[model samples]
Target: MARSETESERLKRIAILNARLPRTRAIAQGVLRDPKGRVLLCELSYKREWDLPGGVVDPGESPATCVEREIFEELGLSVTVGRLLAVNWLPPWRGWDDALLYLFDLGVHHAGELDPALYLRREIAGAHWRSIADAAAHVAPYTARMLEVAADAEHPLYLENSEPGRTR
Candidate 1:
């Protein structure tokens, strides 16, 4: 087995590397179902692929707030941010060793009709409601795991990947 660095050491190394690479913050919101099984997702502009609704977490903002704000901004719908679902640490790159992914469970307040035209202005290529099964196949495995955990109802805030600097 590979020896793992302590959390403190990881933090120190991350701090040093963060000084060089551009730092960015983002929040991914999983808009959950009320009693039924459904969620909201959007296809990103850069990837032009399907993904959860979210965006860069602004400066001096909390992850929960970021998720709520990002969802509203991207989808034009009201959502209530719930408990933390996952925190995925991305792999090292270009003198930078980590990226924090804050995934949150979303309790939608007001649902809206699908409108493909609005997303063009936001640089969002796609947006729609997805059944849990459909979403599981569309997202990354780690993200899929999060959806599995969130939809179970019995388990919330489950952490599937633990390696701090590793990608799933």
Candidate 2:
């Protein structure tokens, strides 16, 4: 027969059980454009190519909040995350599990408005506004595709693995 458990023991048991449950990883990215229609990309200290301003969603946080939080943490820029731009599902790659990437529209800024020196965080090596063609060459393939779709999207797009076959 089992004896009654103490409150502390019960809490510990629940924590252990939670740790064993499967988890899904979600990332949020923001799309910002300059007055000249150049896309904003940040050079990460850990990666060779540039990426949008965002990061992984923390547990119990919504994707919208995650993007705003990540941008502030990464760029020191407080931005109102606007409409959802795209949702791309990524398969497992680089030894990481599959993840869903949420893209948010951050609207446009005038030329010379954003000063890299004033807002860039330590994790960012640099920030630049580049034409779509130039940004495509500097970002990942999936990112390039997302940019293309986002630029012309009249409404939010949902893609499966960044492919057109599945969109809603």
Candidate 3:
């Protein structure tokens, strides 16, 4: 027979159970377009191809907040993160654990809005605004898919393995 638990004991047990629940790493990426409708891609020093202007979501941080923070940190630009464009589930790849990527629309930017002399963080080698075709050539496979979906999506898309599918 099981003994009844006190209130404190029950709370502690609940906390333990919560702690043991599986967790997934999250990446928040921003989609920023130039006036000519080209997407912005950043070249990172650590990777061969370009990527969006965002990073891993910190613990206790919201996806939106994480994207905004990462963009500022990487590009030296303060951006307003808009509607969620896509949520993609990535299986473990390149030694990384499975992760959920949240892509948010950062809206379009005018040519004059960007300062040419802004110092990019050391992690970022350069940045460019390229057409979707050009962007696809420069970004990773998953990122390329996200850009394609975001460009045509009238509503948010849920993707699995970089393709649209039923959500788990």
Candidate 4:
């Protein structure tokens, strides 16, 4: 029979097991819209396509918390996260590994209230309010699908590779 383990030993074992498990990266993004239903998209310096405002979730940080933090960090705007919008599974692409992306609502604001010039982050070239159809031409194909699905979805969605999935 095996001897009982101390708390420290148990914790060490758990840590080892945790590290051995598969790690799927998590990304958090927020959908900000205006009364006209135009979505706010950020022009990224690193990428050609404009994208929603958010970033990778840090260790021990919740997705909601991560979006709020990323918004302020990248856009210099303090925002409260709203309801969850969608959960999309991304397959390995563009030299990056697979990741799960959480989309959250950031509520609506008057178009005049948001000024892209004020977002001084180096990574952000600009931000713009674009209609869904118009945004598709400026964003990635997957992002466009995500926007279309999320906008039309009546409830929270679960997507696989940016498309509607069997699981909700």
Tell me, by TM-score, which candidate is best. 4
Instruction: Give the root-mean-square deviation of each candidate in angstroms.
Output: 8.6, 3.7, 2.5, 1.7
lDDT of 2 by residue, 103-168 (tens): 998888764655676655557887788988888889988888888877668888887666654523
Order of the predicted models by lDDT, top scorer first? 4, 3, 2, 1
Return the TM-score for each candidate structure. Answer: 0.64, 0.82, 0.87, 0.91
Q: 53-130 in candidate 3: lDDT tens per residue?
A: 899999999999999998787777899999988889998989988999998999998756665466365778888889
Model 4: how far is 66 from its true place, Å? 0.9
Per-residue lDDT of 104-143 in model 1, one digit per residue for the tens?
Answer: 6676432345455545454676765677688866776655
Off by over 4 Å in 1: 1-26, 92-97, 108-117, 120-122, 153-168
lDDT of 1: 0.63
- Over 1-168, each residue of candidate 4 has an lDDT whose tens digit, in order, gives 989999999999999999898889999998899898889999999989999989999999999999999888788788999888899999998999999999988899777776676775678998889999999999999999999999666789999888998953
- Assess candidate 3 and give its TM-score to the true structure: 0.87
- Angstrom error of the Cα, residue 160, model 1: value is 5.5
User: In terms of TM-score, how similar is model 4 to the real structure?
Assistant: 0.91
lDDT of each: 0.63, 0.83, 0.85, 0.89
Weakest 10 consecutive residues of candidate 1 by summed lDDT:
158-167
In terms of lDDT, model 3 sits at 0.85
Candidate 4 error regions (>4 Å): 1-3
